[model samples]
Target: MTKKIFASIVTICGISVMAVMLLITALLNGKTADSAAGHVRNESRLIASAVEKGGSDYLYHTDFDKDMRVTWIDSGGKVRFDSHKDADSLENHADREEVAAALKTGEGSSSRYSETIMKKTVNYAVRLSDGSVIRVSGVHSSFTAQLLKLINPILLILAAAALFSALAASMVSRNIVKPINDIDLEHPDAQKSYKELAPLLEKLRTQNSKVSRQMDEIQSRREQFSLMTESMTEGLIIADPKLMVLACNTAALKLLGAGDFHKGQSIYSLNNSDIFRRCLLNALGGRRSECILRTGGGQREVIASPANSIDMVCGLVVFIMDVTEKQELETMRREFTSNVSHELKTPLTTIYGTADMLASGMVQSDDVAQFGENIRGEAERLINLINDIISLSKLDEDSAPRENENVELFALAEEILDRLKLSAEEKNITVSLTGENVSMPGSRTILSEVLYNLCDNAIKYNVSGGRLDVKIAHAPQRAIITVADTGIGIPKQHIGRIFERFYRVDKSRSRKIKGTGLGLSIVKHGIMYHNGTVRVDSEADKGTVFTIELPIEKKNNEQGEII
Candidate 1:
């Protein structure tokens, strides 16, 4: 706009200056031409009157401008005297336009130009009384020559005018654009600007308002997306087709073991492992891919899916789940199935073999009773194994109803000790009960099983002459039970998995102890069902202590009701 304004001003000023110069030049040239013609006519009449008195001597004696010419011709068309030429060589004046006119009308005037029109001649003729003609002529500048004579001045004036126009145009253009430049686009004021620009300002204000709304909306959506992604427990990542990380959550950073994560960083910067790259590249190629990535923290399942738009793969979204616990559970399930099959097969095979031998009557009469006794013992072992299995299944599935009752921990500990008295005797272990007889709201059947398992494990694993102590205490809202045994304590490495089903510290010793390995597992699950916590303390070759704390008031557990 500024350039346009400046150019327009300069163009208009140049045309106006040139127009004024042309008009002035034409007026001056016209006045000069008229004055020169008048001078020639006056000089011709004076010369004619002088010729009537002083004839040809007046033409010779009179000194005029070098540009002036004089010619005298006789009535018979012969040139008698010439100022700038020989009278005999001059052309006859009888046929000349000015002289012919003067002879008929007494006076005549005419103008002629050179071939180039650069010089003009103004001629005036007069007829003398003695049948002769006198003519005087003067050279004058043509319009073209006059214009050429003023060319330098005209150019100088135009140069000065152009310089002035440039300066004035610059100032005017700035003034014309100043209001627009000063306008505040964020918040425009139309009243302070030109009235002609009010409509444009209003339109600008409207556009600003619309853009502001769109910007605010975009910011709001961005914040919402950030909040949602940040709150996710599963690791999430969004990447462009070039594998640049567009968005990532905290969980993704932790899962991928990434540090100082920033947008636009390559996904390989987070984890450059082969499995991660393979899955990501597959997704970038428009194929969904999944793989397990093992890291220092745990195992993660990475699922990468292509984000498609209009049949084109625009980007990718990756989901990472910490499946360490799930993998561990799967392993445990397989091991439990294998161990259960082995354990059930052993007792069944023993019972079947003993009964079959008795039925076949291959034994002599002296061994019949012994055979029967062996069969009964093996059968009882099978039944016990089945019962333990059933108990574990019930705890795992939580498919049985539980009836609430007030159960005393000390009494429960005493009852468990009584039931295990013979086992304790066989091991030559001493048993004792201590602490308050605290009672908590729970199912009596479940509480009995919990106390029995702990006490049973205490006696079963204790060495001969080892002491078993069961302590019960109560807090304001919880019942605490501590069962400690002076048995071969668990090793440090195996302590973490002590409560796992069929997980024995010494498998040979445990098998010889005449007990199933599901007792500790049952104890753990029963305590969990009661909304309680259990912890173990032990050292190799020393003893193991199991401490349990249960809420006095019934509360809902994760699986089912506490009752």
Candidate 2:
């Protein structure tokens, strides 16, 4: 608006200056024309006075022509003399305005009038010595009118020039302002063109850029706010001042189990629960509140807070959170604590009972020794169970042992078979190790422990005369080790839970065999910490094959070799 006003003022000032200049020029032209005409009339009167004073001499001595009429009239209205014809034949001229004025005043005068031979005349009348009139009139043409006629064309040309100049000025001004009109003030190019504009244009551009930058900053802040809201993990919803749904997030959509929540959907429509509606109403009323809502699948706990200082479009932002899994885990933790206490108490009671009997010396010396050994064995079993529990806890923590070192799987498997060979021999189970030497980049102690546990379990659970095989092979990027035993194979239902701590296929059979039920769990976590996987294939009453694949050290191209 201000720019338009300034442009109008500039245009008006330009036209006003041109008009004032033209008016002064026209006035000067008129004054010059009037002065020239007056000078021409004075010169004509001086020539007339000279001729009248020397009339007889001019008529006799000078070569006066017959076509020229030279007459002298007296103040009494008589033609005193005529050069061309009889004096009486001429009309009286003393009564003429110029003649009478010259006779009375004795001064020369000029007048313009019509004559018989000419349409216009320039008459200069002068008084003679006897008070007669001598009038000299020139009838060449309308000289003053002719000069003025020439002025019209010049005036027309000047007017046309002025018109063209005004048009050109307008077009030039528009052309200069055109680029400025299209210039984006927020852009760098607008600032680059600052040196080209006039002072006013430069000022305008500076103001425009400031306003544009301010608007851009506001927009950037708005975008940042939007990103924060959208990227939030917790679900968010916004509503108008009237408490109508306006916007929601992906988490909200999943929580609602609906794809579309159009505008005007009530808070109750989202959950159809009184608790949610009441919470929303309380938030809308400027009271912050938190409510837990149970849906068909799970529970959602939402905290609603009133928004302060809304924009022109008033709205409120609501935050929501899901705590169902956390609640479930809390409940499971409490139950697990009770179950673990019960599980440990039975074994501790058995060990305590055997120790008490041996201390009391209730049996023969040999029997008492045997009872003491039984108590010792039971105590050892309890210690093993506690140690396994501790190991499983360490695995759950996912911590790497400090004893990690490069281990040779082939050597580790051979050592494990050597240690378990006696046990295998007692059952008539043949234990064999088959593979080329292969090395893995991990802890030797942990890897050896894993092999020992697998082999021990295979020998302990195997039927009489069964075969146990340990095979080690070099895979593409890992060392593959398999421990197969013809044991009482695991049932399908129990296979999935075999790696879980304290989980057993048959509780009674596992106890009878003195199994701590933590062997597979330890092996699984040990392999996992080494960036390996443990896979088991088993069938009831047949056998079980446990495969451990651990990554092998590779060259720059990640190609491993068999040692």
Q: Rate the local accuracy (lDDT) of all candidates.
A: 0.87, 0.70
How would you encode candidate 2's per-residue C-alpha lDDT over 1-563 as one tens digit per residue? 43554466456655775566566656665675455446445653554566656655654455443323455677787876665669888787766776778788875555454544333444556676776666554443343444455567656665765666566666767666666676654443634344565565666668888888999999999788768867877788888877777777777767655565775786555676788888877877777889987766577778888886753325567777777887775765675465467557767887788777767876677787677777777678778878777776776675546554667888888887888778888999998889988876777766776888899999889999999999999978889999999999998887887766566788778767866667876787677667677788999989999987777862222211111
Output the lDDT of residue 450, model 1.
81
TM-score of 1: 0.82
Best by TM-score: 1
Candidate 1 per-residue lDDT over residues 1-563, each given as its tens digit: 99999999999999999888888888999999999999999899888888888877888888877889988878887998888888888766788888889889988888899967689999998989987889899988988888899999999989999999999999999999999899998889988789998999999999999999999999999999999999999999999989998999999999978888798999899999988899998898889999999999999999999999998999999999999999999999999998888888887888788778878888888998888888787778778878888988888898545868888778877888999899989879988998987888887887888889888888877889999999999888988889999998999899888888888889888888876778888887888888788888998779999888889987877632121
Give the clashing residue pairs of candidate 2, or none: 405-442, 405-443
Regions of candidate 2 where Cα sits further than 4 Å from its true position: 1-215, 229-234, 238-247, 255-257, 262-339, 359-364, 402-404, 554-563
> lDDT of candidate 2 vs native?
0.70
Q: Name the Cα RMSD for model 1.
A: 4.5
Q: Give the least accurate 10-residue stretch of model 1, judged by summed lDDT.
A: 554-563
